[model samples]
Target: MRSQPWRPQRYATTAVGFLAALLAFILLDAPMVQRLEAPTLDWRFQLRGPIAPGPDVVLILIDEPSLEALGGWPPSRFDLARAVERLAAAEARLIVFDLLFATSSNSDEEGRADAALAAAIAEAGNVTLGYAFTFGPEMLTRLEDSNRPPDGTALQRYRRSPQAISPLPHANGTLLPPRSFSGAAASLGHMSVLLAPDGALRSEATVVAFEGTLYPSLTLQAARQFHRLPRSELTADVGQSISLGDRRLAVDSRMRLPVNFYGPAGSFPSYSLFALLNGAVPEAALRDKAVIVGSTAAAAVPVFVTPYDPALPSVAYTATVLDNLLLGRSLVRPEWLRGLDILAAGLGAALAYGAARRLHPLAVPLALLVPGTLWTALAYLAFVQWHYWLALAVPLSLMALAAGFGALMRSQAEQRRREAVARERQNLSRYFSPAVAERLAAKSEPYSLTGTQSATVVFIDIVGFTGICEALPSERTIELLRGFHSRVERAVFGHGGTLDKYLGDGALAVFGVPDPLPGEAACALAAAAELQTSIAAWSDELVAEGLPRLKTAIGIHHGPVIVGDIGGESRFEFTVLGDSVNVASRLEGLTRQLQVSIIASETTIQRAREQAGTAGGNIPLGFHRHGDVTLRGRETPLSVWVWRPAEESRVATRRAAV
Candidate 1:
């Protein structure tokens, strides 16, 4: 088999895979960089006041129309007075404004409006206005020091939001801060923002860091407002709980919270400014419902960009934050998840390597895909159910590792195939003859013949076989047989012969069994002559050892014979079967009767004569004809020959030596 250039190596494969994983890891940010993308959480005094110490909450927005109808910028302070009057009329347990009035009024009309507002404030002792603190600590501290609680009033349970103290920036966009303001209203809380990981509103954020201090986000604030729950009543571990005198309200324990954005979207609660001011909503609805006021005006504002407000109207943002708390559908990524991310990545990589190590190359894809699916599911659960952001880097890296390792192994396999082929080619020539080796190398597999068919056969038997065996001991006979067989085998091989078997004093050989060589008759005769000469030359050694000399008679014939492996279940021999083989054996028996050491068919005699004449210097060979003969089990006659050395050739060749 030929080797391919693209082979996979186990070690190199591992290396390439790890390298790919590392590259991907670096590109995907092995260490995350955090960015904040929350929108503005600012609201007017009307929405911020009366938000705390109360039932679970939902923030209804009172937007731009209210501004237009009541007159803009410090809308008839008297109108805000009317808003309070309305709250008092509704018998609301708490009234928190979403508005702020920072500067003092001086004009007679404004003064009158202010007096009216103050009068309403005095009347509605339950009202609390929203106030914001600017960036600097000293400025906030000064304001905190100077702000006195009303005569018998208590300080707010929550402090100003540090995040609002200063604006935060992220790579994608800015988390806008409101125009910082501080007001005389009590029960004020910093309306802060929540951020998404990529700075997009695809998911919600609950917890945020502000000015070195973490704060409850917009949804939490809205939740606190809805239930009139003070910060003290809300437990981070058990969600929110509020007890307003006798009644109690509850919210989930796990979040700042996120809204489930049900699509068939655009269902956000939006209130036209005019409708809200004219008491368009039933007083019963307004009485206790938390009103979180913010602009839904189409124009983007410096404070309109809340984290959850991306592409949503600001009113929707308010609703989203509020509803998120009520439904416990907050998208709160776990804060202490650095450990999980690292663990996930490490486990994923290890699993990939393990799979690569243990499984076949084909299994690597399944290894990667299976784990990838698991990770995705885990990520979804963490995001939606558990509100945690799980790192996706790990499992993805594992996938890359498996694939990369597989590719490397594939390349290495090809390399090994090439090497194996080279080794095989190198060793093949040693086992087979040059001709056989060449044939084996030409195609798909080794050239071999386990079964056989028609072939010419030959068998040689010594003249005094039984007598020699009687005179010699078994060991000597064995040694003599070994030596004689060795010699015969050499001659047979020289003529491209296959030795089939050997018994007491003779062996069978075939010229055309394994491969049918042309001139089989000629080659067999030459081999026979060589065998005779070889034995005759060994006479000196026989004399020295005081052993009888050996002489063999060769028989040759051409006829169809089944030449192949022939044996029992356990042992087989590549030999011929049929009348032709039997005839050859019978012919061998007649060599002694014919009184010549070599006998061959007329076919062998003729072909030998022609070959000797054509290819000179073949051997010291000569032949004589033995007339037409019939052998045992033969249906037709065969004209045969008894061939010997040239000097004695006439003895056998002359008619009727018998």
Candidate 2:
């Protein structure tokens, strides 16, 4: 038999799974989750290890040895001018300083030193000087008029688009070199770095907004000069990318590029300023290469943490940015990637929910892990192979939430089903034997109790119930009926028959109802014989107690009948309903005229013989053939058999004589 139709619980469970995923997606931008996600990106970089750097850029550090060679902390401008002249003479493609020359000397001797440095910068014609921007509270007090750079300075030659709104980092005031020094420089750009939330340097702003104009970074200016592109080739598209001739460098919404470091500090070729100035390092080493000069001396410049090194010198950080710009290998985390992350999270959650619903309990964990592991592997491969950053934490959280919630919903639904089964068993006990009811209720899978099947139907009644009731008072009549019902229940249930229901003075029982059993006809025949013996014993007790004796008539028939819970919605009964039932009732009435305690149709007797087979010796041999008689509702006459035990016959004869 088939189970009932689909229910709402399944739909409710699916909806809950999707809802959990949506909640996770909403919290993707929370500060705590984002903080947890940051370390994952760091782990990817560490796992990829290090790569070889290109031979296009080099670092010249003013190390401790160079500082000692120069006599003290502040090197003389004359020495700095000599270093510039040497790099220019070597025909270096670009010379960028990760330093600020914002002040001039007070002594006559040092004044000439500053003038000599300016003349050296002009003669070189390819030096890009570094500057700084003040963003502190002091910037608020400075007048805008005094903050402007000198006219015709290198910073003004760069391109600035009027239509593009300024989305780059804003600068409050400038820290430029003296006018004599700046006027002679070929280019000027800011040397500013912003730290990550964790105090690690990972990205740099390619351009900064200042006084209604855009200023390029030190690395950007060096890239422009190294390529020999005119000022118009360097263009900033705020919140998108930087257009450098035919190539576009991707940037975040804030116009920042994620610095892809080749390795730790000294990843690029390096030399000491002392060696370069003293002619110990060959001049040809600087030929056709862009050079960055910064101080590696203790406390000389700020040191920041990077993915590869905990204390990376600021000069090396600038070199990393320039390397990315020249090679077009910067890490990209564009705004559109966030949309893809959300889609992956949503789909993964839904798939996890479906898997948890159908898979076994032990396999559920594996099901949840599969999607999470696959996404993580894909994200790592993308980062290693293509420098693409994919989100890790948010999508995993979504899958876990959906799977857990789906499991909880399934557990609750199971609990509900168990409760329903318990109630059904309690109801079934009213119309069936305890064993039958328990068997029906304990099924692991769903089943239906309504169907058409062949069974043996038995009807039993008190032969003179009406006359006996009149002779007794109301209370006595109830007691008499209870005694008779108790005996009938024992006889039917003892032989595995269903006690369908009780009539006012009679009861109907059936074999093979709800589910069919083997040898059901024999079981029914045995129940009929047991009822005859039980009622006779009860009648003798009543006679000894000076009350009316009890007598019962039973009829048994074997045929097909429809059995199930049938009636109006308000009240229903599990019973057998067919012509077979009517035939059994009519046969029970015939017992009175036949003067026998039991009268069974020939069909029932033949079925019993067939089912008993070689075990027929166990069956009682007291039945006698009776003449054919037409039942009340049927045109055909049915042959029947009657049985009258000797004890019952003697009891009846004595009553007739009296």
Candidate 3:
């Protein structure tokens, strides 16, 4: 058959849809989302500069020295005044106190302490104080006429704690500013946790939205001081830039970015108040730096404990804002990238399906490895170059799935194709030899061959066929033909021969071509014998059906011949076109001439001789050489042989002279 390897197969629409759907699915269920939510690994990818050089950022611990020097819990009121004096003298730009002054008193001693602190605050106007409010919005469940602080709190304001399913006055939401101590300093910032979806305080804050009003973040307020920017100057420019004071602050407006969490966990500095009050680093060390005074005391801090420092106490979350402000660093993930994540997942799923469908088995590993590695490197590059936390999970996951699907689909398709081709080859064997039929089928087109080679061919015919058909009905003739063909086919196949063609009442079978059998003549003889035995067995069944008994004669020969497909596109047959084939046919007819069964040539006789020698003299067969005789077409005659088993059976075979 002629090779036409470049032709494209008809493409299936269902296949495309399947490929696309599979890819989309892979993108959506990316496996890295769990890791993305982890605080530690996330910090590693997003962390960057402005980390205060380790030594510059100082944590002044309010230790036992401060406590013992000025009693605890509402520390000696006089102590607050003195501390403010010293901190103001130290030249701290923003001295923030993470404590509230909520008590009311007119006693001379308390008044004197308050006056002294108030005086210090008036002088050091850079002081900022910490304040806090209840968790959420405030409202009244039902309207009330008076604004007299209500009987307690509006039920809506209370947020209905679970235990409050029973009767109790709702708690009022407190506005902690004047009463909570922010007014004591020039500026006030909330000490609230900007809880993330993963509940890690890596990113600081955006706008603190509540009750339809947006308040400045702690970082923003401190930044306002650092840059000396007013609320009006806090302009967000085109999402790409922001302006605060003279400084165009390096920040994102939609602030869900990565923060440079410097170390694995507890990298935040801590110091003892005893050393600070005693001027441990000398007063020169405190000058020109922003001083944020908060608690390192166990009961005072809220939630800063980390694995690295388990014994560490919680501090006001506001200290984090202060830390971020003093250093000019920020982690930035643009608003646009989240949408990209969704798209990435979907696209990945489709590619996976295509890769699954398209690649061959051996090529599959390269198909997966190249793209998987490329996507990962692109993700890392995005982090370094753009500060964009483009998600790696969905795309990487999709690539993996595509590779897997490609491998699985390739495996399955190959198996199915092999089975299908095998079945087709077998079904054609009823008419053609398996070797010839396989070559024809694999051509991707019907038979078209040229040239030829040496081959062994066999022919079998039903005996007394004309008389049997004449005696039988048309359907009976068909049944007889079907039964006869079945026996011949089974015999030919059992001995590894091809039934090349079937002419009514007979067939041409071959043992060698497109491939040769190890012992073409011997195998051919076995098939012929099996055919004869089968025909004898069928004779009784035919007689029982009120039909004549059936008999068959087979001819086998091994010799040189020109073998190829013959005839036009409309019809063709793989045939041996030479004198060897003619002699084989003549010899089959000569079964009657010789009054015997199988036949052979000198070549097969010589081959059998060598095979017998190779088998340690065990193969039992012999041939008597006959001198050359002229065949119908040949000027030169060819020698032949007659064969029989060493222990002669009734069957005898004569080789035709060519």
Candidate 4:
């Protein structure tokens, strides 16, 4: 088998596919791609449904009833103090507040209320108070005025290394509680949540920087208090992970942790502050459990969008973080994961291109779909089973784009090939019969129409052509030849014969040269008989028009011949070369001497008879045996058969009567 020739189009198509994928890779960090990709993570969370949170964490919500019982939205500090006192009395392991008390009260009554709350928090000794860091240009002044740094001892206690917290989110101003409250709290952690570009809170900064000091998040502080881990056991390895005792949790370069929610807002065990205050909750329920206290009143606490809940309360969101920390499981997307994402994009593009090349163009999308579906399933499994955050949208996007571009290029290449074939067919039709030209042009691979083959050759010419031209003008003579050639072309092509070339007033046609047919001899005979009758009719019309009458003679022979395109580099002619061609020409010359319209060699007659018998049909015309005769350029006398059209006899009789 011959090796197929190289095609540049295939390489071009593959390059186009890769280029499309490269473009997608470059835009991996674009806001549009990020926005589109965010929902996929949400989908994974929803599909995984809800799981039971660790029993170590619980929520204390200051809900609508609590607000009503306390008389307003922002419950008095006296009421807050009472709630803290109640939790402490129940021996709650830790009380973390997701609230802020940044300013002193203006009235004496409110001032007394503030002092009472601060006293209660100091008494609890295990309470962690939440504060926020203020950002933006407008807050710079407020940040400077209120920049009383927290106790250095407390700050250094959580700081493993300054370099570890350098990359964390920076804040210019602090939203700290009043001095009374800040000094009374056992620990202070920032209550700053990180939102995605689309304003959905899916993660939080585990550590934040302010005034050259690092502060832990409220969730982290709560976890530390619950676990009772030593300060040395809590370590921050920025851009990699955070070690809490023996457990390591992944974090991104910005010291942010992708929060993995156990479920929606109410997944963890929650108790109403109103119930805790009224003694409706059992003391055992609160004992030794880490409690997060915040208001759930719509007007008091801010609502955040989470993966599982569109409007999740801030307290529940904090509880989710603490739950994840206690369980030592959170969605992992470290800085190194970006390298894997890039690899995935490239590999997906290559797969799509290879599939498109092997499959049909119409099925390109389906081919892309298979790998895309598989990858999605695997990514979801990774998320649920391993808590791994694999890039989804970028890889799938690259595959789709690559397949689309590749298919478009392939379609264009096919169109160009078809156009070239159409032009080649038109050119071939000029030399060969329509049927032969079509067969040659239809081949997809390069091929040769040249070979040595058995065939029936036919030759036809106008008699007395030179004399007839002398009596007519040049224009009229040229028109006469065109008419004659047209008639001959019709007869030859109609019978599947290749009209090789025209010889001024004559033409040579052959059957079964390019492709062999079982009835090639019979077909040749049929063509000759038809030509003889048509030429006779044309001569009668010429006579009626007062033009000189015309006559034509035909000869056919069947034999093996060499057929191919033969000539110099500049030009070529597809024609047959063999003794059979010469024999057929000589037989045509004998038509004038024998005074017959058509003549055939004995071999041709025998072949024709055989073909007709095989086809179960009668021969197109009858042949009368003509005795052996010597022909020009032949040493042996060739036996032949001759035929005269009945149309010629009828024309002669009609002319006599006229």
- Name the candidate that leads on TM-score: 4
lDDT of 1 by residue, 540-625 (tens): 68978899988888888766767544556666444567777777787888887777787777765655455564533133357666
Q: What is the C-alpha RMSD of each candidate to the true structure, in Å?
A: 14.2, 6.3, 8.4, 5.1
Q: Can you tell me which runs of candidate 4 are displaced by over 4 Å?
A: 1-21, 145-172, 207-215, 228-248, 413-454, 460-488, 500-507, 513-519, 529-554, 561-577, 589-598, 606-628, 641-658
237-305 per-residue lDDT for model 3 (tens digits): 322334455554343333332444443323455545555555564556666655556565555555542
Model 1 worst lDDT window (10 residues): 37-46
TM-score for each model: 0.49, 0.75, 0.71, 0.82
Q: How far is 605's C-alpha from truth in model 3 (Å)?
A: 7.8
Highest lDDT model number: 4
- For each candidate in the order shown, give its overall lDDT on alpha carbons: 0.54, 0.79, 0.55, 0.80
Model 4 lDDT per residue over 1-658, tens place: 2324435544654565556557655876677888888999999988898888888877888889888887877888888898899999999999999887777899999999999999999999888888888766555545453465467313344434556666677787777788788788877778887788889998878877776766778777678778886556666776577777788888876788888887777887888888888888888988999988888898888888887788898988888888888887788886667666776666667677667765787788875887688778888988888888887888888878777766776677678878888899987776567878998888665444455689999999999999999989999999899999889988988887888889999999998868886688888888888887888889899999889989898889999988876777667667888989999999999999999878899898888777775542235645567779899977899999888666655665588799
Each candidate's clash count: 50, 0, 13, 0
What would the per-residue lDDT of candidate 2 be over residues 1-658, giving only the tens digit for each residue? 1323334544654575557557655766575786667778888889999888778888888999899989876777788788888898888888888878877788999899999989988998888888887676557536454456655333333433554445456778888788777788877778877666777778887777776677778788788888988777887667677877777877765677888877888899999988888877677889988888888887777788888899888888888888888988888777667666777677777777667766767777765798788888888988888888778888887788777766766667677888888888877776677899898678654443455689989999998889988889999889988888888888888878899999988999998886776677778877888888889888899999888888899988989898876667566667898888989999999888888878888888888777775333234656767779888878999999887786665675688799
Q: Give the worst 10-residue stretch by lDDT in candidate 2.
A: 1-10
Question: What TM-score, to 2 decimals, does candidate 4 have?
Answer: 0.82
Better of 1 and 2 by TM-score: 2
